[model samples]
Target: MPTSSRPAAFATAALTAGLALWTSGAPSVVYPVYGREWSLPPALTTVVFGTYPVTLLVVLGLFGGISDRIGRRAAIVLGLALMAVGTLAFALAPSIGVLLVGRALTGAGVGFALSPATAALAEYARPGRGHLAGAVATASTAAGLTVALLLGGLFLDLLPDPLHLSYWPLLGAVLVVLVLALRLPSGARSSGSAVRLLRVDPSMRGVVAQGALGVAAAYGTGGVVLALGADVAVGLLGTDSPIVIGLVLALSAVTIGVTALLARRVRAGAAAPAGALVMVAGLAALVTASAAGSLPVFLVSIVLTGVGYSLLFSAGVGIAAELAPAQHRASTVSAVYFAGYAVQAVAAIGLGQLATAHGLLPAIVAGAVVLSVLALVAGAAPFVRARRAVRTATGGNPA
Candidate 1:
C-alpha cells in the first residue's frame, strides 16, 4: 500500500474505533439519571452497564477473528451500522428493558469493530511507525469517552431530554462515519478458518499472554471506576451534580490521552510492567479515598489510574500488533481485548453487587486487592525475564 493513502484509512479506522467507544461512553454519564427516574438500585444500574460488555464478549468470542477471513471493510461497516441503530434505540428508549437492548446492540457493534479497527490502523500505519497505531488507538478511545462525557454532561445540564437529545448528534456522527468507512480500502483476505486465526503462534504465546493480562488488569480497574465511581462520589462528596461527575470521569480519559501521546517512544516491554505497578498503587489510593470519603485523594487516584491505564493499553496493544503475523494480527488483537473485556464485564457487575450487598468500602477494598495482586504479578514477569536473560549472558554473576 502507498504511504499517501494509508493515513486516510488509518484515520477512518481510528474514527471507527473511537465511535465504538463513544457509544460506550454515552451511557456512562447517564446511568444515574436512569436510577433517579426509574427508582432503581445501584445493582440495576450496573446491570444496564454490563449488558454492553456481556454482548461485546460474546461478539468477540464468535467474530473477533472473523474480520481476517471476511475482510476489514465488511466487518467495520457492519459494526458501524449496528452502532448507529443502537444509538437510535437509545434515543427512543423509555424503559430499562429497552435500554438494555440498546446497550447490547452497542456492545455488539463495539465488539465487532474493536479488534479489526485496531488491526486496520496497524496495517495502514506508515512503515516503521507501526507503534503509533497503538498509541493512536488508545488516544482515540480516550477522545471518544471524553467527548461523550463532556457533551453528555452539558446537554444534561441544559436540556429537558438530555438522553434523547445527546444521542441525536452521536447518531449523526455514526452515520457520517459509516459513509466515510465506505471509502476505506478492502482488507486482504487471509486463507484459513477464523478459528485457526484465533491461535497465537508458539513464539508469540508468552508475549501475547502477558499483554492480555496487562490489558485485563488495566481494563478491570477502568470497569470498576466507570460503573461505580459516580455513585461513590455522590455518597462521599454529597453532590448530585451530573456535570461534576462527568468532569471527573472525563478527567480520567483526558489523562489517558495525554499519557499515551507522551509515552509513544516507550517500548511495550518496559511500559507494561511499569504501568502494572503504578496501576496497583493508584488502585490502593482509590480504595483508600473511597474508604475515607476524601474527595482530594479520590481525584489523585483517578489521575494516576488513568495514566497507568494509558501505559498498559498502549503497550499491550502495541506488543500484540508488533508480534503477530499480518494474517493473524486482527485475531491476536481481538484475543487480547477478549481477555480484557471479559474481566471488565465481571468487574463491573461484581463490584456493583459487592457495593450493594457488603457496602461500597468493602467492594472498593476487595476490587483493589484483586487488581493490585494481578498487576504486581503481571508487571514483575517482564523484569524477572530480563534478569534471567542478564544472568544467562553473564554466566551467573554480573559483577
Candidate 2:
C-alpha cells in the first residue's frame, strides 16, 4: 500500500464501520409503522430489532477473524455486498418473515465488516495519533445512527413510500462503499483458524474482559434506546409524529459524536470510570423522565446517554487496540464487539418483552439498573486489581 493511499483507506474504513450501524438502525424509525401495518406486538417488533444482533453474534463467533486470514479489503467488500442485498430485501419486503431475513443478513454483514474496519483504522492511523482510532470509530458509528434516524424520519414524513424509500438510499450508499472498498489496498494476510485467532491469550484475558464489559455497557445502552426510545418519546411528548420522535431519539446519537471528539484526549483508564458514573446518572434521569413525562428531562437523559456511550465505547476500543497483538488485532477487537453485541441482543429482546408484559417504565428501570451495575463493575475492575497487587506486595496489608 502506498503511503499516499493510507488516508483514503482510513476514510473508507471509517465509512465501512459507520455503514454497519447505519444498516442496523435503518429500520428503527419505521418499527412503529410496521407494528401498525402488520398488527404486531411490542415483543415481535423487538424481536425484529433483536434479530440483527443475534445473527451478528453467530457470524462473529464463526468468522470474526476472517479478515486476518483473508484481508481487510476483501472482508469489507464482501460485507458491503451482503448489506446491499439485505437493504434490497427490506425495500421489497411484504411480510415480517422477509424483514427478519433481511435483518439477519444485515447483521451478518455488520459482523463481517465492523471489527475489520475498526482494526483497519488502527493500522491506517497516523503515526502519533493511532490511539485516536477508537474515538474516531465511536464517532463514526454515532454519525451512522444519527443519519439513519434523521433520514428515516424525513423519508417517513415526506416521501411517498415511507417504509421502502428510506432503504433504497441506504442500499445505494452500500453499493458506492463496496466499490470504494474494492480499491482499498490489501493489507498483510496470515493463515490461522478463525477460532484460534479469536482466542485471547491468558495474560490478556483480564484486559479483554474489562474491555468487553465496557463495550457491553455502551452497546447495551444503545440497544435499549434504539429498541424503545421512540415509544418512550411518544409517552413523554404525547405525540406519534415520526419526525419529532426521530429528532428526540437522535439527541443521543448527536451527543455521542460530540463527546467522542471532546474526550478524544482523555485516557482510557480515566474515561472508563467517568463514563460509568455519567451513564448511571443518565439512566436515573431516563427513569425519572419516563415516570414524570418530562420532555426536558428526557432530552437531558438522551444527551447524557450519548456522552456516556461515547466515552465507554471509545475507552473500550482504545484498551483493546493498545493491548492486542499486531497479528491478532482484528480478532481481539472482534472479541470485544462479540461481547457488546451479546448484551445488546439480550437487552433488546428482554426489555421489549418486559415492556409488553408489564409496562415500558418497569422495563426501562430494570434495564437501567442492570446496565449501571455492569458499567460500575467494568470501571472498577482495574482499580480492584491494582489494590490487590498492592496488598500482596505489602504482605496482605490494606492499601
Candidate 3:
C-alpha cells in the first residue's frame, strides 16, 4: 500500500490477468485443426472455445473478493497453478470434453487471478498514477492476447508436436511470471475479516454501465475476429497462408497498445468519447474491408478498432477505481470483465451459428452494430454532462 509501488503492481496484475486471458488464446493456432481433430461442428467448436470464459465468469462472480481476506500473492500463485494444470490436461486431452475441462480450469484460474491482481495493483501504485493504471492493465492483456495467437500459429505451423508444443511452452513462461509475482510486495492490504460480496457504490453505477458496453466492444470484436477472420481471409479473400491471419489479429493488439499510449496523455473523460468515435470509424472500416475484400482496409479497420477498444477499456477501469470503495475495487473491476466475457461467450456461440448459416459476415456485422450503437451512445452521454458542468461553473447558460 505504499505510494511508489502502484505502477509495478499494475503491471504485475496485468501480467497475471494476461496469464489467464492468454489461456483463452490457447486455441488460436489450431482452431480448424482442433475442431476437425476433435470432430466438432463450427458451432460446437466455438462452444469449446467459449468454455473458458463461461467458467471464468462463474468463478469470478462467485469468488471475486476472496483475496481481500487472504492475499494477492496467494490468489495469483493459486491461479497460475490452476492454469498450468489446465495446460497439462490440454496436453493429454483425447476428447473435446476433456478440452472443455481444461478450458474450464483455465477460466477458473483467470477468475481467481483477475480481481485480486487488479486490486493489488491499486494498493501498490505509485503517486498520481490513478488515471493510467487501467490502460496499462488492459494494454498488457491485449498484448498478451496478440502474443498468444502468434505463438499458437508458430507452434502449429512449424512444430511437429502440435498438441504438446503450443501450450507447454506457455506453461513454462507462466511459471516464470509466477516467480516474479512472488517477489511483488503486496502485504495484506485487505481488511482482516471474512470475505463477502462487496456492494456496488452509486458512483460506480455509470462506469459499470459504460464498462459493460466498452468491454463488449473490445472483446466481442476479438471473439468475432478470432473465430472467423482467418477463414474469411482464406475462403472469402482468397488467401491460403496462416501469416495473414496472425498479422491481421496481431495488428489489433499493437493498435490497442498504441491507443493506450495516446490515452495516457489525456484525461479519461476526453479519451472515452474519442474511443467511441474511433470504434465507430473502425467498425465502418471493418465492414468496408470485408465487403470489398480489401486487405489494406481490413488492417486499417482493425487498427482503428483496437485504439477505440483500448481507450474505452482504460476509461472504464479509471472510472471504476475512482468510484469503487477501496476494499471493493477488485470486485468492481472483475465485474466489468465479467460483462466482457459474457459478451464474448454469447458472440462466439451466436455468431458461430450465424457464420454457419449466413456466413461470417453477418456475425461480424452484428458485432459492429452492437459496439457502434452502445459505445457511441455512452460516449455522447458525457458531452451533455460536461456542458452542464461548464454552465454551472459560469453561473449562467452559455449563448
Candidate 4:
C-alpha cells in the first residue's frame, strides 16, 4: 500500500470496526421506549438485546478467517452492507419479532467486520506503530458506542419516531463506510481453509484462556450495565430522560476511548491483570451505589468501571494480536471476541430475567458480584503463571 493511502485505509477500517458496537449501542437507548411501546417485560427487552451477540458469535466462529482468504476490504464492505440492512430493519420494525431479527443482522455485520478490520488496521499501520493501530481499533469501538448512546438518546428525547428516527444517521454512516471500504487497499491474500484457521493454536491456549476470562468479565459486566443500567439509573437519578441514561451509560465508552489512548504504552501482562482487579473494585462500588440509590457514588462507580473496561479490553486485544501468528491474526482476534460476546449474550438475558423476576437492584447486585469474582479469578492467573515460571527458572527453588 502507498504511504498516502495508509492513513485513509486505517481510518476506514477502524470506523468499519466501530460500526459493530455503534449498531448495538444505539438500541440500548431505546430499550425503555420499547418496553413501554410494546408493554413488554424486561426479559423481552433483553432478548432483543442478547440476540446481537449470539449472531456475532455464530459469524465469528464460522467465518472468522474469511478475510484471510479472500481480502480484508471485501469482508469489511460486506459487513458494512449488512449493517446498513440491519439499520433499515430497526427503522422499520413493526413488532418485537422484527426488532430481534434486526438486532441479529446488526450483530452479523459486526462479526464480519470486527476482526478483519482490526487486522487490516494493523497491517496498514506504519512500521513500529502496530500497537497504536490496536489502540485505535479499541478506541474506535468505544467512540462508535459513545456516539450511538448520545445520539440515540438525543433523538429519542427530541424526535417523533424515537426508535426509527435514531437509526437514520447510523444507516447513512454505514453507507459512507461502505464507500470508504472500496477505497481501502485489499489486504494480501493467503491460501488456507477457514475452518483450520479458525482453530486456536495450542501454544496460545494459556494466554487465550486468560484473555477470554478477562474479556468475558469486562464485556459481560458491560452488557448488564448497558442493557439494564437505564432502569438502575432512573432509580438513582430520579429521572426518566433517555439522555440522562445515555450519558450515564456513555461514561463507560468515553472512559474506554480515553484510557485506551493514554495506556497504549502499557504492557499487556501488567495491564490485563491489574485492570481486572480494578474492575472488580468498580463493580463492587456499582452494586453498593445501586442498592443505596446514590447518584454520586453510581457515577463514580461507572467511571471506574469504564476505566477498568478500557484497560482490560485493550490489553486483551493486544495480547491476542501479539500471540497469534500473522497469518491467523484475524481468526485469533475473532476467537477472542467470540468468547467475549458469547458471555455478553448469556449475561444480558440472564440478568434481564433476574431483574424482571426479582427487581433491578438484586439483579444488578448479583451481576456485579459474579463479574467481580470472575475478574478476581482472572487477575490471579497471571501471577500464578509467573510464580510457576520462576520455580522452573530456579530449578525447583522458590527464589
Q: Could you tell me every candidate's TM-score relative to the true structure?
A: 0.91, 0.93, 0.88, 0.91
Which candidate has the highest TM-score of all? Answer: 2
lDDT of each: 0.84, 0.86, 0.72, 0.81
Error of 4 at 257 (Å): 1.1
lDDT of 4 by residue, 1-399 (tens): 333288888788888878878887888778778999989996688678778777888889889878877788878888888899989999999999989888888888888888888887777778877766557777999999999989987898899888788899999999988887888777778987654435677766766677777777778878877767777788878888878888888888898899889988886777777788779778888888887878888887888888788778877776776656677777777877888888887787788778878988889888988888877766776677678778978998985
Sort the predicted structures by lDDT, highest score first: 2, 1, 4, 3
The TM-score between candidate 4 and the true structure equals 0.91
List candidate 1 stretches off by more than 4 Å: 1-4, 38-47, 192-198, 384-399
- Which pairs of residues collide in model 1? none
Task: List candidate 2 stretches off by more than 4 Å.
Answer: 1-4, 38-47, 194-197, 385-399
lDDT score of residue 298 within candidate 1: 90
Candidate 1 per-residue C-alpha lDDT over 279-394 given as tens digits, one digit per residue, 9 for 90 to 100: 98789889889878899989888998898898888888887877687777877898889888888878878887888898888888888899888777667766765776688789
Top candidate, metric lDDT: 2
lDDT of 1 at 242: 78
Tens-digit lDDT track for model 3 on 1-399? 232254565667778867766777876667678766667777676676778777887777777766755667777777888888888888778888788788888888888887777666566667666666677677777777877877876777788868656878778878877777776665465565434554455656666666656676667766766666666667654765565677668888778877777667566677778888988898888878777888888878878888888887777666665556666676687777788788777776777777778977776787779768877865764565567658878887666
Per-residue lDDT of candidate 2, residues 73-151 (tens digit) = 8888888988999999999999999999899999999989998899888888888777888898999998998899999
